[model samples]
Target: MIVAATPADYADRPLYAPIAPMLRRFPDGLPDLATLQRLLEASAPQAVSGGGRPVRFVPPDDALPAYEARIHASGEVPTRAGDWHDFFNALAWCVWPLAKSACNALHVRELAAREAAGLPGRGSRRDALTQFDECGIVVVTTDAEIPALLAAHAWEAVFWQRRAALRETTRFLVFGHGSWDQLRQPFFGLCAKAIHRVVDPAWLRLPAAERQTETDAWLAAQLAATLPTLTPRAFSPLPLLGIPGVTPDSEQADYYRDTRQFRPRRA
Candidate 1:
């Protein structure tokens, strides 16, 4: 329930910081299908569906094939008009076209494999893919310890003890449209499934736009190579509020002590 009348309404919100570049494209109001298609063309000319067809945004319709199937069989993405979730999804495609297509391709492959095996429902691989699609965050950093701490659920160690180091070395990029939608009204319990990438420290010095572009390319390649063996275990849960500076409350050491959100790692 984000009720923003226009993209600009939420542009300055801290949670929307990751997608600010996409938001800037639509200043006046929510983008229509045509506008989205145009933006896609401009931003990612080579962008295609899982089946290699050119990607295009389209209004939602019952007559269309199942969501992922349609994107795989045809390039049309069913988008709901004026919906925050769908808008962020389209923006995700624009920003991370190759990665998104790889995800769609993985979904199609998983679905086909399940059918061939006579499985009646989605399998674990598909579930993991969907979970990441809905709430994934990419944590790119030069420091290996940051991710290691995160994997161990060492909240204070990662967010507080290494706060300055993280600011200088890591970049958290949101890849989940569902997470983006939920961030519209951030809650203390909001968390994301993070996949970490240890990049060269030189990347930290690149301009903001270049950094994002580089990340998009790197992520696409990583997904293409790893999707076959990817699983839920590959992700580490990160409570959004515990991230330093994500919220003002997080600046206080007490914020990380909230056991309700920053639960201890299981024995």
Candidate 2:
């Protein structure tokens, strides 16, 4: 009959075809771990980076039950727009706020490449974490910051799992945000079993020592060439000399606990 479909009619179309079936997969026709993961994998699937690593689009099984509980608990299951956004919200909450975002993959992979090339990189990169928060920046701080940082470390474990799959990486400096001067006093003695070299914020504050050192000059020069956004304000030692300053961790391991323990002490 060549029926004319109006805007409302057109809007009724599903963003994904199998969504209804997926939603119905559980015993009582509710959400299931497999379907939720499948939806995430299909919608914004992540690919292997630098042409080295197994494809990982699906959320790990451990992550799925938690995701299902969130949406069902939140009661935000979308019948109008599409089920995927609900799924996206779930992933964002379960992982990072930006897990569905393409930039999550793009930014991490791009940063990884720069680090592999032996360039200067920032560690304790909490700003990257803040980018996902509702409040863009915090003029002042609060107790909530520690939880947020812990959450970031948890997601970082998943991200690092994907890092080992990356083949082209040789070196890169990865860190989150902290303060300007409080390094040794606040940074703790970060000597470790997994990642040995931790850069203290105070080390960067030392100028006279840096100019005279060979390591400082090379790192300064490399970081400049690699990342234009993060120019060094002062000289700092390379944290990834013998051990990787910011080695990505495996998603399926004790990596989350291992990771959060090392994140630069929060302000």
Candidate 3:
């Protein structure tokens, strides 16, 4: 049974323990990215090459053009399959932080020693980063924000960003008016608005204690209708290792089984 709790229920615990222990259940959950990449190297190193798509780094000088072109090409415009990949690519930019971590992992492996100059800046791996951004990444998936996802295979970065920002009392105060839906157009805007619209800025300005109580109550209510796993956690419930793209069949799910999930079972 779902409880009557609001997001604050999970967000406002205490200075030391405001975040609860994440309840994650997956086949493989790496504590850190380095360990995860090592396992990938031994098991399915091909993933490093993006399933053989020939990933190239956007030259240090040309990275901006590539990224800018991508942003402009994917503007609120429509196109054929040839152009859809590029559009999806641009939409995935939000996952840059996670990808940055992975690239950092690679840099650590390639270089035996490092100078301050030798550190891997975002410059050296823009291509890999872009691809991961373009293709949907496998993250721990959840319900509260699922309605805002653009495609079944990919998630809406705005949702994760919202959840992250709301955890803090102060950030929640400033960004309260901004919802994840504002970042991407959901397939069902009416449904998303009906559900997410209920939480407004009025609730944001409540006393920390009050906000916690109210958010917990509200999220708890949402739990009844959504597949939301309450508690502090990583990205989501899935064992998201790195980037994961859409797979039509198991034969295609070659990147990371731990992160790749089958379609959610709908009753």
lDDT of each: 0.84, 0.29, 0.27
Residue by residue across 241-267, what tens digits does model 2's lDDT show? 112222332233454344334354334
Instruction: Give the per-residue Cα lDDT of candidate 3 at 173.
Output: 12
Q: Which candidate number would show the highest lDDT if scored against the true structure?
A: 1
Q: Alpha-carbon error at 120 in model 3, in Å?
A: 58
User: Where does the lowest 10-residue lDDT sum fall in candidate 3?
Assistant: 172-181
Q: Rank the candidates by TM-score, best first.
A: 1, 2, 3
TM-score (all chains, Cα) for each model: 0.93, 0.22, 0.20
Count: clashes, candidate 1: 0
Per-residue lDDT of model 1, residues 138-196, tens digit only = 99899998888988889988888888998888878889999888877787699999889
Candidate 1 vs 2: which has more TM-score: 1
The most accurate candidate by TM-score is 1
Stretches of candidate 3 exceeding 4 Å from the true structure: 1-146, 150-153, 156-198, 219-267
Error of 1 at 3 (Å): 7.3
